[model samples]
Each structure stands twice: as structure tokens, then as C-alpha cells.
Target: MTASLTPLPLQGHVLFRSSDLDEARARVAEVFCPHRLDTSGGGAFAARHHHLAGQGLSLNYIEYGARTRIMPGELGAFYLLQIPLAGGASIRNGAQGYLSTPDRAAILNPHLPTVMEWEEGTRQILVQISRAAMQAHLAAHLGGPSDRPLTFDGPLDLTAGPGAALRRLVLWLVAEADAGQSPVAAPAAGLMAGQIEKTVLSGLLDAAAHDHMAALGRRRAAPRPRHLRLAESYIEAHLDQPITLEDVAEAAGISPRGLQLAFRQHRGTTPLGFWREVRLARAHADLLTAAPGVTVTQVALRWGFTHFGRFSELYRARYGLSPRDTLRAAQGG
Candidate 1:
């Protein structure tokens, strides 16, 4: 599918309400991937699902009255984070099984087949993230490629720390959607929508317990000057892409902490500072030869500078003129 430029926008507010098992199943497939729901608590079976989605992430509220078992099969390309709002559920991810309550969350790893059994009155807030987008973000964060699958240590504790904070944010976003005031629903939130999705994914990677969590946060020995040169070269080559500090560190075959220490000790600036300087220089060059009808915002965004004001401020500091001034002069010349 050709990706939609706008994250969900207003299209995801559709509510699915049904009492028939077959009916609910069909509606859910439209919101999430195909899944089978079977009731074990008996009586009248009913389900409710309210889905909100962006380009790379989705937030949903789901409830199935009467005890139930949902087989989502092999997610294959997505991770479903289930946070119960009421009651509890037992989630099986591969050999490990997690019993999640209102204070806990279950992150269903994509590679593992997942089975979720809910209590009779359970309700949950579900966040679905695209696997490719998430994995790419994780690799970028760790400053190296993820050679193996990111395995969660266990269930997430929502009562404290990053997990609690992430839950609050999700709830706030959900409340916004419920009130029809969500940023994703705003027409002006195009690029901003993508940022929100990326932030959510990054937060999950940062907070959630995973095999890579330790490595990403671990401090390593400072990189040699030769390694710093390799990183600088990599940054110069891939300046146009979304290159992070981690990318540079990985290219230099060192940890992010080590790369930062080396840059400070040698260059007197952080790796990110050096990277920003290079980008500023490149943006200046692009502005000089920018095509007709090109705006400063166009040039700024083209060079991976998202915030126009910040870019202008940095550009002015480096070149002794605002980006607009530089572009204006280039056009005039």
C-alpha cells in the first residue's frame, strides 16, 4: 500500500459495536489485523472496539463482556501493547505467559504467536505499532543494527516510571480522540502527526524492558580518534537521511556514550553538535542553488531540519545571517 502522508487524520474515529461474535470479529479485522474471538464465560456475547490510528501507530479501546479467548495468530509485522483499564487478562507470548491487571501491561512481541484470555468484565487500551517503523527506530537508538529480535523481559509495570508515564500519555491522547480534539484529527497536524507516532514508538523502546535495553543505556570505553573520523565520514556521506547520534556511533564501531566522550575530548563538542554543524553547512549550500519557487522552509526541511525557527537561529549563528537572508541573497545573486 502506498503510505498515507497524513497520519490517520479523522478517519480512525469509527466505532465498532456489536453483540454477535461474527459481527464483532469482522469489525475488529477492519480496525486491527484479523483475529478470532471465542467466549468462554457464556451468556450473551458482546464486544466494543474504538480504534484510533496514525501513520505508524494505533490506539484502541476494546472490551469483551463474558470471559473470552482471542487468538490474533502470528502478528508477524506488528507489536500489540495491551494495557487493561479494568479487570485483567492472561497473555501468552511464546513460552512466556503474563497475567496483566490494570497496573500492568503486556507487550506482545510480533514474532511470537499471542493468545489473550480476558476476564468477564475486562477492558483494555491497546497500542499497535508497525514492526518495521519500530525496529528501525530501535536500531537508530542503539547506534547499531539489531542483529536479533528485541525480546521483552516480561510484562510492563504501569504503576511507576516510564511505563506509568507512557500510559498517561496514551490515555490523554485517547481522551482527545474521544472528545474529537486529537492532534491527529487536526488538518494542520500533517508532519506533526508523524512526530507523535515516532515519539510513541521511541518512548516504548526507551521504557519497555527488552534485551537491548541494557546495551542501549550501557556506557562503553571512549572511542579512539580513528573511530571518530570514521563516524564523521559516515555522517558526511549520509547527511541527507535521518541520521541520529547512534547511527554515527555504530558506523564508528563504538557505543553512543563512547562516541560522545570521544567527540568531547577531541572536538570539544558532542557528536550531535558536530553532526548539526555539518547539516547547517549543507543546508547553506542547498539554499544558494535552490530551484525557483523554493522557500526557506523547503530548504530547511530538505536538509533534515524540522523546526524552522531553530534552523534559522542555528544558521544565523553559524553563517552570521538568517536562513531567509541567505536564501534571499542567493536568489538575488
Candidate 2:
């Protein structure tokens, strides 16, 4: 579908900038901290921002001054991603503190009170994506809750591995927005924003999973398409063979969790869910056109539906019709 966006001023809606520390601090207060600010009356301040919000997702790109004071209790509302473009920042979340530098990015979930202090003469690329957006993406792709903000604390070192491509894409996106020549047309821009939101989310989840793997002393090798295809084909060939996730994992010579992960990465669906859908689709086709004398029970059994009543119920639920109704409609056609 074609996409579109509600255009907003970068400085006002998506980005805020002011040389006057007071003005800058005031701007921060409008969204995060709603109180008076203490800053020099006059200073050289500049800021730029651009963003696209689409399909319950928001992607904001912002660059601001090198040194800025983040108020306390300001991070209790939104989940923010801070990517250093030129300098660095020291962030303190109560007792937990970390340094965010140009080579590294820090993710902050605003549920906890925290403060940020940007380094002097530094520039950063900030992407403010919303939680709802992450959830939507998860629903579409992974079929689960996308709760919890993920923090990857270190130099993304995107210069190597799978992260490199993403890093380059981010840089390009920032540049296009700044140049006023973003090829992302209105709707396309919105779509791109959504994709970026999902990509970031997937990265964070994958990183978390990687951390878990590390804890388990498991190192993941690069995934191979052939391996995924072998696993999928195995499932398809044995759809009615009384299968278990463990069996599939064994056939593929991987752990059950690893099998699940592979299926998610390759097919964007759980292995068993995909198998059930396949069976249901086949049953649907058979019900639609299986000769004049075919019965609903026969179609169901042929598709590995062991329980006639349950099959009929599930069939009706999935296709909005009983198997008999589907046959009748097909004959009428």
C-alpha cells in the first residue's frame, strides 16, 4: 500500500535546538521535564531533526549540541535511543552509569529516572522510536509481545559483521533527511520509518538472545539457507507423521530453541504454526473442489485432522465457513 506522513517542523516537532542554554533547557522541559531551567542567557546552539511516523511507529533523527544537561526524573515517559555521531555522553540511571560515545549507542527506557550529560563539542544522532511501534512490528513478524527496552552497551562496531550494513543504512538515512532530498516520498517515508523501527527492534532482540547464548557458552555460527530449507522440508514431508518440535530439531541437528530461532529468522513464523497453517490451507483447497461426493470428514481426515468436530470448528473459525459450505460454494461457482 502507498504510505504517507504528517509533516512536522524538525526543530519544533522532531528536533529542538538553541544556542541559549535556557532555551534549549526549556525545550527539553516541554516533553520530558516540565519545570524551570538554569542556563546562560546567550550561547551558540544549533539543532536539526527529521522523523517519520507511520502505522503506530515513529522514527526520529535528531542531532544536537555537544554539551547538554538532562534534567532528573525526565526519563519517565518514552524509550529513547541515543547514537553518538561525533562526541559522547555520560548517562546515569540512579546507581547504574555508562558512557555513550560516538562508536557506541545506548538505549534508554524512560521508565526509570535518569540524567544525561553530553560531552562538550559533541554531536549525536538520536532515534526516538515508540514502544507501540515495536509491538506492532513484533505482532506482524514474530507473533509475541515486544515489551522491554533493550540496551546494547558498547561500540556497535558496525564496521564488521551483520551490523555494518545497518550502520551504513542509518548514516544514509540521516544524510538524506538533512539534505532535504530524502528519496523517501511521503508514504514511502512512512514505510521506511516503520521498517527502521522493526529493524532496530529485531536487532535489540537478537542482541539479547546473543547475550543469552553467551551465558550458555554457545556460539552461533552463521546461518545457512540450506540448513533452514532442510528443516522446513522435513516438516512438510512429515506433516502427518506425528511430529514434535524436538524431532524437528533432532532432524536438523540443532537444539529445540535453536530450531525455533532458525524458523523465526527464516520464515517469520513458529515451526508448528506454519505447519498447521499449511495443513489448513490444503484442507481448504480440498473442501473447495474435491468432486461431487466428497464429505467434510473425508477432507478433514485427508489433511490429518484426527478429530472431526475440532477440525470442523477450526476450519470454520479460519475460513469463516463450514467445510460443507465451502464445497457448496465451489460447486455453485
Candidate 3:
């Protein structure tokens, strides 16, 4: 049976505003988990929470004042990654402790007791995931069953690489949900929503330091022929969607770097180059058949080309004629 997940509001929850302590605490707890919250920032507690929820995953933006502390009870079923957008937090998870900020994120381990102290005026976006969902998903990607629990070390530095991409994915998903453009919110998004969720899951699985880190990051071993074929097929099918190299790797059950090497070895081009080639090819066909109302720029955008001049240059270089010229000829103008 195909399980139906409650869709996110394609346009996310509007800024949900409240200023009462009892209400804010209860509300935040309801969205997350119930726990003890004592505020030493004793002034009135005002907060804004913008949220979007999908299958077993959710993203939220929250800002509330606190000078003392918070004891969010153990989340035995879910994992959380808390990242501040403004101030920061001093957090204690079991024996682990860290200072989390905009440039860093705290991966709140599931099945552990937790406490946190957020500075005054701290605004943060929290990503929550079901532990079972992620672990099972990870095991599938590794092509086997996992014997041990996945646990992270500490705060994730979001300044560069996959960490940065992970942060951007959360923000972008929130924005897309808010605009009703994401698979979570758009009726036609269908399997793409699940695909996006899987992509996020795999990205974090690869980025975070966990017990499964070695297996996930094993780049010395190359991907199998079938894996390479799967990655290429995923890229070709999703060219018009907002997919990244990591997404393609996830679909192929390989790390991004490993997938790149496989592509270079087998196809004589980088994974991204292959994607560009595929998109350019389709955009060319679209330009040739463009109707009177259709424009060259529109065709380029449809193929995920964001830069008009760059797309034109590539289009001209590949087709030996500009996209506009092709469209004009198709229109008989």
C-alpha cells in the first residue's frame, strides 16, 4: 500500500505570532516535545514560529527569549538538528556539550536526555527527523541492514561543503513550501516529495559524523556499473527539477565525490557536466519547437537555466546558433 503523508502547505505556515509565556512554551512544546522551560530573561516571552512538515521530516523557525535554561525531555523517537540564525545556545546532550550558532548546528541525539540554554533574542531554525525513518533510509542506501545506532559527535560546522548545502536545503524547502512550489505542498509533486525527503536524509547521513560515517564516506571503493547507470538515469529524468549532485548521488546510493569519480571514469565528464549536457540538449529541442507565444528565455528557464547570458552562450556554442534565433525560426518570424 502506498502510504499517504500529510502535505506541507506549499506556501508554509505564515509567521505564527504569540507573546505569552505559558502559551509560547506550551505551543513550542506541542510542536516539538513537552519539557521544563524556565526563563530568567524574565521579561515577556514573545516568539514567532514558521513551520513546514512532510512525511517523517519537519523544519521550523522559532525565536523566543530565555536567560536561564530549558530541559526538553528525551526524544526517544526523533532526532533534531538545532541551528541558530542570530544569537546562539549552550546545549548539553547526555555527556556531550556544545555551543551552537548560525555557523554551527547541534545534532540532538535521539534516546538521550537533553538540556539547552538559548541567549536572549536567539532566532533559530530546527530540523527534526524520525530516527527510525533516517536509520532505515540510511541502511537502504548502504545496501544493507544497520546493526548499530547512528550517533553524532557534536555541533556541525555549516560554513562550507555539504554542511552549507544541508543548511541551504532546509531554508530552500521552507521557502518552497511557503510558496506552494515544493513537492510537499504542490499537488503534482507526487513522488518528488519523497525523493526530496530522501535526498535530505542522505545528505545529512553523509555530512554528519556518525558511527556509519566510514561506510557512508568510503570513497576508495568505486561504484558498481548498476550504480553508475542508476545515477545517470536519475539525472536525466530530473533535469528540469531543482536537483543537485548530492541528490543524484543519493539516488544512486553513493557519496557525491564517489559518484563524480565514477562519472569521470565512465563518461569522460563530471556529473555536473553530464547534467548540463542533458539539460542543454532538451532546451535545444524545446527552442526548436517553441510556438509563437513561447520565448527563448522561457525555454531556458524551464530547463533549469538561471543565467540567461550563460545559457545563451552554451546554447550557441552547442547548437551553432543562438536559442533566440532557433525560437524565431520555429515561430516563422
Top TM-score prediction, candidate number: 1
Judged by whole-model lDDT over C-alpha atoms, candidate 3 comes out at: 0.73
> lDDT tens string, model 3, 83-176?
6777889989888998998899989877678999888877777878866567557646644323345678778889898899998888788767
Kindly give the stretch of ten consecutive residues in candidate 2 with the minimal lDDT sum.
1-10
Off by over 4 Å in 1: 1-12, 185-188, 219-225, 228-333
Ranking by lDDT: 1, 3, 2
lDDT of 1 at 309: 88
Per-residue error for 9 in candidate 2, Å, reads: 14
lDDT of all the models against the reference?
0.74, 0.55, 0.73
Q: Write the per-residue lDDT of candidate 2 for residues 1-333, one digit (tens) a residue.
A: 001112322322354545565666566555444533332223344544445443433345444444456655535334556666566777765455778776566666544556677665455555554433443344344322112232334334444554555556555655555556543334556456555556766665443222222312222333445656677788778766568888778877788898888666544556676677567767877876778778878887777889988877766545445777778877774
What's the true lDDT of residue 14 in model 2? 58
Which regions of candidate 3 fall more than 4 Å away from where they truly are? 1-16, 186-189, 218-333
Minimal lDDT window, size 10, model 3: 1-10
The RMSD of every model to the true structure, in order and in angstroms, is 13.4, 13.3, 18.3
TM-score versus the correct structure, for each prediction: 0.64, 0.48, 0.60
